[model samples]
Each structure stands twice: as C-alpha cells, then as structure tokens.
Target: MSRTLINRLSHARRPLLALAIVAAALGTAHAGYNVWTGEYTFTKDELQSAVDKRFPATLRYGELVSVRLSNPRLVLDEAGNRITTRVDAALSNTVIPSPPVNGSLALNSGVRYDATRRAVLLDNPTVQDVEVQGMSQYREQLNAIGAVVAQQLLKDYPLYTFKPEELRFNGKDVEPGAITVAPDGIRVQVNLR
Candidate 1:
C-alpha cells in the first residue's frame, strides 16, 4: 500500500509542473513589451518641435482678395476617423490680420489643431474694412491682408498643404472644395430644395 501511494503522488506532481509551465508561456506571449527593444517612452514634444520647424511661421493665411466666402466645409481623416466641418453663413473682410510672424506674435485668426495629423485649420475668418487714400478700397486691402497672413504661415509651417475638395457658395456644393468656412456654423436641412 505504501509503494502504490508513493507512485500516485509522483504522477500528480509531473502534471502540475507541466500546467505551471504552460501558464507562464501564455503570460509572456500576452505581455505588452516592445518586440525589438522591450521598452516604451513618450516622444510627443520631440515630434511636435520637428513638425513646427518644418512648417515654420510662413503660409498661415492666403492672399487677400475682395471675395465673398459662403458655406465653407472641411473634412479631415486621421487614423481611420473622419471628421466633417462646415460653416453655414457667408463672410466678407477687408483687412485680414497677418499670420503669426514668429513664436512671440499671437495668432490673429482662430485655428483648430489636429495633433494626430499635425495639421492646423482655420475657420471662417474676417477682418474689418480699411480705407485707403480716401477710397473704400476694401478688395485691395483685403487681398493685401490675406497675402501677409499667408506669407507668415508659409514661413512658420513649410510642410503644410491644402487641396480644394469642394466649394459651397450660398449652400450649393462646388467640386474641388476641401476647406469651407461658415460664420454661423453648418446646419442640416431635411427637406429637398
């Protein structure tokens, strides 16, 4: 009886040891570790600095022209997420402020920043009308203001690029206008016009 009991105990021990080994192997397989270096660290600041340098202070705004902008829209895609933006009302401006010339200069226009894509987007922007030589030269002044802003942005962010995807003038969709600006914000209309 003693011999038989001892043999049964040894057999149980072998299976228990095998189960422990299998559990350990699975744990290691599921562990979160860098496959190559087995380490992880944050690098957001370093990446942001490099992006800022590449894009610099120029090309913040575009050339100024006496034109009306109505129903602007923007579609952004990041990491498989799509974001749609639009403005409902139209805007007119004469003296758009220059883009940030340097880090010290405050941005005259509001811009939405997408950290994932490293992109900055400007919404409906406007500048007060200015008088030149006693004439209401709103168009020329607007164009000049736009030029200044664009130049500054270009300098600051050289890598920034824009492609026109759609144009919505007075609520009608225009092809090839990528970014749209609406002061009152976008609204959904259910009824067919």
Candidate 2:
C-alpha cells in the first residue's frame, strides 16, 4: 500500500537469471537451454522508499489522545527473516494543554509475496517497542495505540514488485516463488507460472 519502487529496482536488479547452463551435448555446449529462473534483490534504499510513503499518519484514541507517526527507518533482519522499522512519533492528549510528546517506535515485520499484486508485502508486522521523549507516563498507552495505527498503515504494505518484462522472459510466464531475506537485500526467486 505504498508508492511503486519497482521502476527503479527493475533497472538495477536482474531477473530470470540462468543458473545452470549445462550443455545438452558436447557439440552444443554454447547453446544450452535457457533456464528461466529469476532473482530479485531489493536494496535498503529501495525498501526505505517503500516505507516512507505511508508516513505522517494520525490516529486518535479515547477521544483524547492522538498519535502521529512519521519518518519510518527500516532495518533488515536477515537472521529473523524480517524487517525492523523505527519511526518518529508525536502524541497529543487533548485532555491537557501539554505540547505533543515526541518519541520513536520499533516495529518488526516478515515479508511475503502477493501473487495478485505481483509484489512483496509486509506480513505479520508488530510494533515491538515505543520510546517517547519526556513522556514515559504515556508509553503504555502510546505503545498500544501505535500498534493499532501501525497495523492499519503498514499491513500488506508492498516492499517490491516485479515488472511485466521482468516476469516474462523467453516466452515463460514467471511468478515469485521463494523469498529470501539476506544481509545485502531481499531476494525473490521467480517461478514459471
């Protein structure tokens, strides 16, 4: 549910890489059959751009407290096979004349491929922590509200999508099959449809 980052990635990431080009016969070694497998790697910068579009969001709680979240910084967790995001937050409770509370939030999310959309999206995302500067008293409430808002804003958020040309190569219709979260980037293997 964010702006398309594939246009840029389509130019940088290679798809449908021929992994095994074994020759059928010794004489035809140079003309090996084409293996239509694809690998899509998403850089951190590309992922960040996808996370940035859904920002500057506002959600009100209990008709008094309102939370505004923005500037989501996404960190890839190859070990956990997920992404951790930190966002700047502002909380304002109309019950008092106090200024908005400033803080940050840490959220972790797994990635999955949506065939219908032909894109990789956030899966099972959760807000792990919330830190509000000078507003420890509201941390508990803010955390609760942050999770709700994050779910609303980030649920099914698309990280990357394959372009039409990238999906089709040598007369094969390919789709995303395997998803790997790695240190360098998120890699997706395209499977023939």
RMSD per candidate (Å) reads 17.8, 13.6
lDDT of 2 by residue, 1-77 (tens): 22367665654554422222232332143121223334666778888888888887887777888888888888888
Which stretches of model 2 miss by more than 4 angstroms? Answer: 1-37, 137-139
* Model 1 bad stretches (over 4 Å): 1-108, 119-122, 137-193
Q: Counting only residues 3 or more apart in sequence or on different chains, how many pairs clash (N, Cα, C under 3 Å) in candidate 1?
A: 36
Candidate 1, lDDT over the whole model: 0.33
Best candidate, TM-score: 2
lDDT of 1 by residue, 11-126 (tens): 98999899888766644553321223322111323223333442222232334323222232333333322222222211223366533111111122333433344343343333
Total backbone clashes of candidate 2, pairs 3 or more residues apart or in separate chains: 1
Relative to the true structure, candidate 1 reaches a TM of 0.19
